[model samples]
Target: MYRYDDYDQRLVDERVAQFRDQTRRYLAGELSEDEFRPLRLQNGLYVQRHAPMLRIAVPYGLFSSAQLRTLADIARRYDRGYGHFTTRQNIQFNWPELAKVPEILAQLATVQMHAIQTSGNCIRNITSDAFAGVAADELIDPRPWCEILRQWSSFHPEFAHLPRKFKFAVNGAKEDRAVIQAHDIGLDVVKNDAGEIGFRVLVGGGLGRTPIIGEEIAAFVPWQHIVTYCESILRVYNLHGRRDNKYKARIKILVKALGIEEFRRQVEAEWAFHKNGPSTLTEAEVARVAAHFVDPAYESLPATDAGYASLLDENKPFAAWVKRNVRAHKVPGYASVTISLKKTGVPPGDITESQMELVADLADAYSYGEVRATHQQNLVLADVRQSDLFKVWQSLRDAGLATPNIGLLTDIISCPGGDYCALANAKSIPIANAIQERFDNLDYLYDIGEIELNISGCMNACGHHHVGHIGVLGVDKNGEEWYQVTIGGDQGNKAAIGKVIGPSFAAAEMPDVVTHLIETYIANRHEDERFVDTVRRIGIEPFKAHVYGNRQTEKKVAHA
Candidate 1:
């Protein structure tokens, strides 16, 4: 709910005008594709297979009802009446005409939103936990820090064009919902023994070709110096990160080339110069930013609502939905509800124009007029009152957004692969749909427990396949599409990249392969064990054998 002031409004307006002029020049043949590539990419415009894709940044995944309506309008007028929510909490319009992008950006500016830094080799949107301020286990509201970074990084000339793109995530809760360890820079808000607030910084973590978990660069950076510490890390990376080869350009490669100790030393040396400089945040500034993220007007109510309890007792469907889509809130009378966008037949994260308006209306009526997008490509009503849970669920169910499969196997994270992205070797949406159809049974999915199945068209890892419990990567085998599988990846504080499990299979063979993997997990699991936990404990060999040993069985399962 941060409102833009005159300065913020001016900046966005000027950016829109600037891009409009650039677009005009490009259209008039004054700039070649090579010349305009970086310019357009910096504004979040990518030329996909069929058309130009525009990624709109939703900072920290927060949106007001008005902004949601604006997005819906843009989708209906400028796009194909739908938008794809991404793992970074951004939204993508897959079929926007390159000529009309500036017009679309002008519309976005009216709502205080823009696509700046959503793409290209600059710091992208600063993300945080979807339940940042309201979660039961939150240590602090990370939205303030996320906003602070967004301000600091937006159009910052020093880091505008680095070796490669950069990402930053903040985890303010005990649960690592932000998946900080998978970002270029990760921050965990912490309180020291003396009760002073600070941050634990993790640097050089990414998930592309050479996936590596970040290392702790600073154990404790005081709140006032958080910006200074981040600046130091970015400065070190800007100067030392590889630039010759695009594949090795990320900061992770630089950190690997220089050991963590050396990287830490370099960052420390850089930090000493600006630790107490003008960039160091003051208490007043911190308070000013934090004020925007304060708790909503909560009513005085008992810890348990009678009506909510009665619904849980009486309605099995509602109970199941609460079990999966609802999360505990810090406030006793409130809950956070995840509106799943991954319906069985629909492409994961794709939301139609009508659905966006519906969510906006629901947010206004039930969630304090605000919505938060999760890194899992879903939307969150972060402050829903427990008393209104059934009503909110009913509205969401009517919109086909109440899938009740949060954290389940069918809640897949995927990218627009060969279907839209020219860089993709195989189609990701079809694979996700196939898997979702195969695992459509909610009861069976709940029994199977929490499983992250991510698919990417290529190794760009846009779908974060490397971090999923069940990771699928599409590869180009000769001229055909082959899918490779990986397991045991996790994206929490203890992040780990998955390992390849032998030869790749044809596209039609993926569902059966995934089923066998699930069957193997069920066979090997202990009481109430998660798929990832089981994989970590038992290793990938058992699942691999089950998938590869019985081709006839896999064929039968695939046909079924």
Candidate 2:
């Protein structure tokens, strides 16, 4: 984790004071709701259904154990005993008192954390792969670059008020775990055939009502010009993006209207003016940022330890957890563990205050004193030793954080829909809970294999339902809450938006509908074929037919 310096601390401390005054005015009725909307939004405070919600940014999803402890304390003291981690790798406190939010921000500032640029029409949090530094398949560590961008994007005067909220993601690994294609500006840190570091820039990628996989804007932009190039793209968007309609104001809409080639031309034209400007990063600056993220003190040991092997052989539950929740680390005798927040009976990504404190303690005891938040609404101890795997598993299991399903169907990504959010069309948490209960059998989940099931309350796609293998979106049909299902969506290197499967169903039929899709996958799949691969092989027709029945009945319903 990058520690804040004097300048960073000063800026955040000043912002907290500013927001505190704004909050006081709003409460005193000196500022009307219309006047305070942007003021509160800039501070990551939202007026939700019942109370004010405060979103705190975990830049690139990285935080120290001490910072985690502070978050836990905030949850315990300020809001309810729990907070929800979001798909953007941020956390939300749903029941924070409006007057108490400034105090919350001040507390966060003490730990080198704040809510600036987390909301409003500005550059949002810069995210990346959670396993950036430790992943075995990683080519470059994205944390340093993400940090550099985090500094650059936060409170940038040029882009302070853009047409819409902007987002970007950087992926330094061959595997696209960060879901780069789903961001407004996706940067793939790469090396060319000539062995020079550069970026493969993808633009116009976003998933809201209008879902899109970004088009390649540039084949490669040299490492020195990454920031400048990003500036160029944002400049073009700020100048030409629509302000007439909020729904049509995103960069993706601009890219679609102008076409990729034209969009690229405009960006390139803007880049020419600032190609070698002050924003261009030097080798020394890059190295300076990179120095903060060097490898941890990993002990030299055999790839597989005897104690680890023995525990795997002796404990079946631990073995299952190891298979799904644990991942290979760059170090020989270490592993990255995903502490499952998707346990049964709990909402996805909702961690209790006690659970947060326990995780912080576990991170210090087993891994380093750092924990990571993943885009799938899970937490990761990115440097757990292989020898201590069993002990960590037991501790997590005791704390109800050890659900053996990581990439399985039960590990759902969902939004706090009508339960807390006023923007939601239906209740997302209940739907997610229903699905988790419906697929609680570990044996059945393992048999089904890796499935990305995402649920969104509305088309804002906070849950990224458009990219799920089985995407579920809540729709309002008449006065009833209906659920719409989509299939064949993926968020890997070959990202694609999900296709809708016929008409929407009542919320009561959601779990069965999902089951029908999974059963269809199992029946149609070849040996060892994953659910997503099977969906790609056989289109959504089979699943749709199974869920909705024949076209003749569909025609009757349309007539009726």
Candidate 3:
């Protein structure tokens, strides 16, 4: 993790002090609720349904064991006993008192963390692959560059108040785990044919009311000009992106209106003037940042652990956990374990303070004291030894963090919907819970296999509904909660937005509808094909028919 220097420390400290004063004024009644909105938002505070929610940034989803412990402390002392990890890999406390947020920010500053840019129409947290440093197939770790952007964009005067929130993601791995194609600006770090480092830049990709896969604006941006090139793109957006309508303000809409060719031309024209200027990165600076991310020391070991094999043979639950939660690592005898937060009937991505403490302790005892937060809202012990897998599994199971469903149908990605988010039209968590309750059979979920179901409260797509094999979008219809279903979306090399099946369903009918969709897939899919591949091969007609066929008749028949 990148440590904060003196300048970084001072900047955060100053911001904390500023927010502290602002909080005091608000509490004193000098600042009205309307007046105080943007002030609090800029600091990552939101007035939720019941109470204020404070989002704390976990930059690039990297945190030390100590940092994890600090977060646990905050959750225990400040708000509720648990915190919700967001889809962006940040964490949010739902029940914080509005007046105490500045104090929370002060505490976060001590750990080199803050909530700045976590909200607002500025460059949000520069996310990267959660498994960046340790992924076996990575070309390079993307965190250092993410860190560089984080520093540069923090309180950037030129683009601070943009037309809408800007998001950026960098992926250096062969697999697009970072979901780069779904970001406002996506950078793929690649080595050229001549073995020189550069980037494949994609711009204007986003998922909201209008979902789009980013277009490639620059095929091979040189390493030195990353900052300048990025600035050029932002500058272009800032100048032209709509401000009259919030829905039309995002760069994705601008790109759509202009077309990819024109958007690329404008960015190039801007970059031609700014390229190799003051923002151009020097080799020394890159090395200095990269030094912080060097690989960890590893002990030589065999490819497979006999002890692990024995443990798996002895314990069925542990064996199931290993099959789903454990991932292959570059180092032999080492594995990356995902501690699932999607336990049945619990809010997805939420961890209690006690669970946080347990995970921190386990990380220290089993995984060299390092922990990672996955983009899918799960906690990871990245360097766990295969030999200690059983012991770790036992500990996690006891802590309620072991939910042997990593890629299964029940491991849903959901946003804090109507229960918490002001923007949400309906409660998604309840819908998710209803679905989970309806389909609590592990064997059934396993049979369904490797399905991703994402739910968003609204069209903002914070839950990444567009990328799920089964996507649910919560909509408001005549003061009633309704859901629109989309099928066959994916977030990989062959990324595609899901197509809506047909008419929306009432909240109560969602689980049955989802079940019908899955049944349709099972009935139509070819042998060994995943849901996405099957959907691609057969198209959405079968699923649509299953979902919407004779809707009026079916409703009447059910009533009868």
Candidate 3 structure quality by residue, lDDT tens digits, 428-519: 99988999888889889888888899999999888899999999999999998999999999997887899998878998898888888889
TM-score of each: 0.98, 0.98, 0.98
Evaluated at residue 363, the lDDT of candidate 2 is: 89
- Candidate 2, residues 9-93, lDDT tens digits: the string is 9999999999999989988999999999999999998989999999999999999999999999999999999989999899999
Residue 130 error, candidate 1, Å: 0.4
Candidate 3: worst 10 consecutive residues by lDDT?
545-554
CA deviation > 4 Å runs, candidate 3: 550-557
Each model's lDDT comes to: 0.92, 0.92, 0.90
Q: Going through the candidates in order, what is the number of backbone clashes in each?
A: 0, 0, 0
TM-score of 3: 0.98
Error of 2 at 421 (Å): 0.6
**Candidate 2 positional error at 455, Å:** 0.2
